[model samples]
Target: MQIETGVSLKPYNTFGLPAVAQTLVRIEADADVRRVLGDATLGRAPKFVLGGGSNIVLTRDVSQLVLKVEVPGRRVVDERADAWIVEAGGGENWHDFVTWTLDQGLPGLENLALIPGTVGASPVQNIGAYGVELKDRFDTLDAVDLITGRSVRLDASMCRFGYRDSIFKQALAGKSLITRVRFRLPKPWQPVLGYLDLERKMAETGQHQPTARQVYDWICEIRRAKLPDWTVMGNAGSFFKNPVVTEDQCRDIIGRDPEIVHYPMPDGTYKLAAGWLIDACGWKGKSIGRAGVYEKQALVLINRGGAIGAEVVTLARAIQESVYGRFGIRLEPEPLVI
Candidate 1:
C-alpha cells in the first residue's frame, strides 16, 4: 500500500482546523487492513481511523499512522416479511445513503436525513436526529480488528448502544475499523414526529400523518434553518451533547430557572437542552479568539475563519465552565478531540 505523508487535514474535518497527518493510508477494503498488519513498520505503529471527518476536532499534527477508511458499497441485502435489510460500505456518505434508501422505497432512515458523516462512523456515536437514533434501525455491522486483522460481525446487542455511544466508543475504542453496516427497516413505516420541530412542521403543513418522504423533507428543512452549513461556516454540528440529569436534579433547576428547556426520558431521567443553558449564560454570538458560539444556535461552536483547534477547545471550555457555574450541570462535548 502506498503511504501519503504530510497531508493537510483542514479540508478533511468539518471544523476546518489546521492539522497534518505525517503518514496516511486509504483502507478501501478489509484486505487493506490485513495488508497493513502484515507490513513490518506500519504494523507496529499506532493508527488513527478516520471516516467522513464530521465528528472530530484536530488539535495537533498526528504522528500515528492515519487509516482513512474508503470502503464502498450499498444494497438491499434481504427482504424479510417483517423488514427490509439494507447494507452500505463504511466509506459511503451517510446522507446519500439515507436518500438512496428512500429512493428505493425504504422509509426507515427518513428521520436521519442530512446528517453529515460516513456510514462507518454512525454506530460509533449512535447518531440521532428528530427523535430517531441509528440504534433504532441498526441490524448488524462488520468490522476488522486493527491489531489482529481478523474480521468480526456484531449485532445490535453486542454494540451496547446508548445516547450517542457504543462499544466503538468504549471497550473497542480505536481498536477496530468498521468495514460495513447493515440496517433493518421494519415493514409498515411509522413517522417519528414527537420532536418539537417535526411537530411544528406537522402543524404548518396540517399533515398529522406524514409519509416518510414528507418527514425526510421536513427534517432537512429544519436542520438547514437551525444548523450552520459546515461548508460555509466550518463547525462540528451540535458542539455539546444534551446533558441527561435525574428527575430531582431537573426539578431543582426548573424551580431555580423556570424557563429551562428539558424533556423527560422514558427511563425517568430528564434531558436538559445544552443550547438553552449556554444561551442563558450569554454565550451566543460570543467568541474566544477565532472560535465563537454560533449566533443562530448556541450549541454549535464555529471556526470564525482560519481558527486553530486550540482556540475552539478554549471557547468550548469557557462555555462548559459558564454553564456549570450557572446551572451546576457540566456540558460534555460531542466531537472527539485529538
Candidate 2:
C-alpha cells in the first residue's frame, strides 16, 4: 500500500469538482485493507472507501484516510447448468466489465451496459437501466469490514436491494469496503426490451428478436444520445431519482398537470419523471454560476466549465425547491455529496 498526502481529487470524481484527500492509500488487494487496519494510527483514524468516483460529488477536501480500491481481476469462477457465475474486482470499470461479460458469451448483463462507476459501487446504489437492475443479476459480494478487518460475503438477500438502494447505502455505509462482486448470469439469456428506448430501437431497426449484443449496442446508443459523457462534460448521469408516488398521489398530480410524464409500477405505484417536472418548471438549460442543467436532458446537472461543488449543490437545491413547489413532490439527488 503506497500512501500519498495532499492528493487532488478533481480527476478522481466524474463531476470534476476540486477537492483534496489528506491521506490516500491505494488498496490493491484485501491484504492491503487489513494492513491499513493493522496500523495503529491509520487504523484508528476515520477512513473513506473510494471506487470509481462516478456516483459522488466531492464538496470539500476529504479529511479522513481515503482508501482507493484498486483490486483487479475478472473471471468466470463457476459454470453451472443454470447460470454462469462471473466475479470481478471492485476497482474494475463497470462498463468495461459489462462489455467483457458479453465478450465471454455472458449475455445477461447487456441491458446494463454503459453505466458509469465500478462493480463495487453498483450494489451500493443497486444501479439499474434499460429495464434491469443490479439485483436481477447479482449473485453475491465480498467486502472487508473497516473496523474489525474481517471479511464477509453477502448474497442477494443480505444485500437487501431496492430501487437505487441497498444495505451498502444504509447499514454498511462507510463501514466496509467492497472488494469484489459476483454475478449469476442465468442460462438461456433473454433480452430485456420492455423499456421505451429499447422498444423504440426495435421499432426503428425492424428487428423484434434482438440478441444480447444488439441490446447492449442499442443501450449504448441511447445513452450516448441522451446523457453527456462525463469525460467531456463533467456531470453525474442522473441528478435526481424518479420519485415514486402512491396511486392517490399520482392521480392528484395527474389532475394538476395532465402532460406530466409518468409510468406505472408493478406494485401499483407511479414513477414520475423528475426531468419532466424540472423541465416543466423551466429549468432546462438554465444555469447558476458554473453549474447548469443539461439542455438535452433536464435530469442531468452539468459542471459548465470549472464549476465548484457548492455551485452544483446550489443549482440542484434550486431545482428541487422549484420542482417541489410546483408539483408537490420532492426530488432526491442520486449522487453522494462530499
Candidate 3:
C-alpha cells in the first residue's frame, strides 16, 4: 500500500474536527492489510483503523498509522429456506447497504435505515435504532489480525455484542481490521414498530400494519427531522448511549421527576432517554465555545462553525457533569475521542 504523510482528517470524520494523520494508508482489500503487516517500518507501528469517520471525535493529530478501509462490494451471498444471507465489504456505506437489501426484497434491516458510517463500523459500535440492533441481524464477519497478518472469521457469539458495544470496541479495539460483514435477514419479514417515533408515525398515517419499505421510509423521515445532516452540519449522530439503570434507580429518578422518559428493559432494568436528561438539564441550544448541543435533539453535539475537537469534548464534559449532578447518572459518550 502507498503510505501518505500529513493527511488532513477533517474531511474523513463526520464531526469535521481538525486533526491530521501523520501517516495514512488506504486499504482497499484484504491483501492491502497483509501488505501493511508484511512491511518493515509499517508493520511494527501502532495502527488505527478508520471506517466512515461517522462515529469518532478527533481530538488531535494522529500519531498511529491510520488504515482507511475502502473495500467495496455487496451482494446476497446465500438464500436459505429460513433466511437470506447478505454480505458486504467493510467499506460499503451502511445506509446504502440497508437500502440495497430492501431493493433486493430483504426486509429485516429496515429499522436501521439512514444510520451514518460504514458497514465495518456497524458491529464495532453495535449500532441500534428504533427497535432493532445490529446484533439482532448479524451473521458473521471476517477480520485480519494486525500482528499476524492472518484473516479470521467471527460469529455473533464471538463478537460479544452489547448495547452500543462489541468485542471490536473492547478486546479487539485496534488488534484486528474488519474486511467484510455478513447479515442474516430472516424470512417472513416483520416490521418493528414498537419504538415511540414509529408508533407516532403509525398514528399519524393511520396504518397499523406497515410494510418493510414503509418502516424504512418512516425511520428515514424521523431521523432526518431529528438529526442534522452531517454533510451540512458537523456531528456524530447521538452523542451518548441511553444509560441503562436498575428498577430501583429508575423508580428513584421517577419519584423526583415524574416527567422523566424511560423504558423498561426485558431483564427488568430501565433504559433512560439520554436526550431527555440532557434537555432536562437545560443544555438544549446551549454552546460551550464552538461546540453546542443540537436544539432539535439534545443527544447530538454539533460544531457551530469551524469548531475544534477540544470544544466538543469540553461541551460534552459540561453536559455530562450537569446530568450527573442532577440525575446521578453519568452519561457515556458514544463517539471514540482520539
Best by lDDT: 3
Candidate 3: where are CA atoms >4 Å away? Answer: none
TM-score for each candidate, following the candidate numbering: 0.99, 0.99, 0.99
Instruction: Please give, for residues 260-293, the per-residue lDDT of candidate 2 as tens digits.
Output: 8888999999999999999999999999999999
Compared with the true structure, all predictions reach lDDT values of: 0.94, 0.93, 0.95
Name the better of 2 and 3 by lDDT.
Answer: 3
Native-vs-model 1 lDDT? 0.94
Model 2 deviation from the true structure expressed as Cα RMSD, one decimal place: 0.8
lDDT, model 1, position 163: 93
Q: What's the C-alpha lDDT at position 208 in model 3?
A: 90
Candidate 1 global TM-score: 0.99
Could you give candidate 3's per-residue lDDT for residues 204-298 as a string of tens digits?
99989999999999999999999999999999999999999999999999999999999989999999999999999999999999999998999
Instruction: Give the candidate order by descending lDDT.
Output: 3, 1, 2
Model 1 stretches astray by more than 4 angstroms: none
